[model samples]
Target: AEPDPLITETQGFAQSLGDGVDATPYGLPIEYESDVIRRNVEWLTADTISSINFTPIHALDGTITPQGCAFERHHSGAIDMSKDEYRLMVNGLVGTPLVFTYSDLERFPRENHVYFCECAANTGMEWAGAQLNGAQFTHGMIHNMEYSGVPLRTLLEEAGLPDDLDGKWVYVEGHDASSNGRSIPIEKALDDVLVAFKANGEALRKEHGYPVRLVVPGWEGNMWVKWLRRIEITDGPVESREETSKYTDTLADGTSRKWTWVMDAKSVVTSPSPQAPISHGPGPMVITGLAWSGHGAITRVDVSKDGGKTWETARLAKPGEKMALTRFYLDTVWDGSEMLLQSRAMDETGYVQPTKTQLREVRGENSIYHNNCIQTWHVKENGEAENVEVS
Candidate 1:
């Protein structure tokens, strides 16, 4: 079989344009794609205008989201700041208190890594019967991107730590009006936390913390404070409102779970989901989506089309180095009938994501944070999807 020469020539010419004309001084989506925008559930969270913004996961692909499409969740809204005026302060139990301008942060060594930031309250809506009508609300509170930043350890060492600081914790807070705060163990702070300045190879957008943000690899997004301004070493957790009144999980036994930070390994099928229904006909359907964990690398992802009764391992594509987003694909033959699709992830630690029933069995229906249960999406005969609760 011979290839079509004219078609190849046209494709090469298109590539040669090299992302031209449409490229901007500050890049925005093409005007035609304006519809691919952040969407929010008007009454789901808080104020109508100042509430959570969800990513268009249904419209994105290849595991990476352009900075503009990534979701934004702010207690007090995104703060505006100039890079030149930004300052990061290190105080408290350190041997010497110090502050660094944004430029000073650049002077330190830098590294690039890709990771996903997911809100601790991501699946809060599932508390009821598939309240959210679309996948944008069901699975859009997360995004993964490559970040460039100095390791927190670099700045901590530069500030000169106290010899007795071995047991102390670090309280990191944002510069936003709410100052969303959290406590990081000293070991984790020094090990992999990053003071990120750029994401996906460009200066961060204002909504994503223009001057700086924390990249607490593999941790919950709440701990990755945006508009990062202060870091103070303390003897224990700050017990801030975010950790207390919010992020904490409640148990059926009348007690609440606290300090539960690490985001467990999880996966979801993006296509054939509510917002992204199966438009193509039955045969040779491709199922794909993103998977990652704060605990460690994703070791396996299992996909089930006949509900959870039968499971098949998926193939991870271009699974990057450790601690980065891993893309998985499952190719199957569809018979043009209604079906239920679900995915479960197992991390390096041998922990399998529990089913929603199993999760509620342990934590009860009142808790919101850490809902890493297996998710089910029902595909109707016409290919539309609906959020479903599978027993």
Candidate 2:
């Protein structure tokens, strides 16, 4: 039998005393993990300024996405703004328009919750077919974080909203060059909307809307305005460029559906995928992935290897939470044979994740956002995986 590597084989890292904590001031992933970083589809966007990069979901596990490795969608490129120069204002239809400095936000009570932020276009590229070859590219436009900040309702209450909330909406905007404003119903703004300052237990990253951002759980990532600046209450939706020209789903008849915010239940396998192909030979293979729902908590996740011809329930790695990413796994033995790997998520409301065919049947192929279809991966005998569709 072979002895332990540390006892029999020599390694420089283990043999010598490494640098102390003071050497790193701030920590980062080791050099070996350089490949585990945000990636962008350069051809998809016109320029990096208003471009997006995917989170390396294939290289991650558990629910909390690391602040440094999370995905970023920059409308006008990431900015560097000082906390001293930040201001948040609550105007329109209020007692008196109130302004708050960066310091003022800290005085309010804080709350925390783990939530998943998914761009509605997470799987939009695959609407026609399995165009992307990796899970990171196909389903990486999402992230989960523990947000710590005050609820928007508290600030709205401070500004004193009208007693009759009907026919009222909140128009929120960011401070970046793009502004990225969108309207939200008064009901959702008062329900679970968060004015987040911290994510994953630290100050928000500049790429993830530093200084401050809005955390609209279960809604499309576009509505989660980063670099948040102002909130204006009004009687109707803003119908801004983002809501009208972009983000909306176009149906078969050339008409489009607007105001579609909630992200439906969806799931995707992470490991043994195209980007993270299996290196080890057949034996015990742990199939794992992330499941999330904007509608509510993920009730259950099911995995299928034969293109959904049969299904087996997968175990939730942890208890599911509302508007948060849930980890799920199916501990099984792979025989090194070919497999059509797939995952389906069921939300608390009993809504099941649909397939591309099912989605196209209802949505048609002309849409761009909110394509939460179940993704499929074709695994070959050599343990290589590719984005594929099953008949």
lDDT, model 1: 0.85
lDDT of 2 by residue, 96-215 (tens): 899999899999999999999999888899888879999899999999999999999999999999878999999999999999999999999999999999998899999988899999
Candidate 1, superposed: residue stretches over 4 Å from native: 1-25, 48-50
lDDT of 1 by residue, 1-391 (tens): 7889877556775667566664686666667987788998877766843578889887777887888889998788888799888999999888789989999889888999888889888887786556776767887888888999999988888778778866789999999889888999999999989999999999988888788999998788899999998999898888899889988888999799998888887778888788888888888988887777888888889999877999999998865345667788898888989888999888888889888888888989888888887888999999998888887
- lDDT of every predicted structure (CA atoms): 0.85, 0.93
Cα deviation of 380 in candidate 1 (Å)?
1.3
- Candidate with top lDDT is 2
Residue 207: error of model 2 in Å?
0.9
Q: Candidate 1: which pairs clash?
A: 218-294
Best by TM-score: 2
lDDT score, candidate 2, position 338: 91
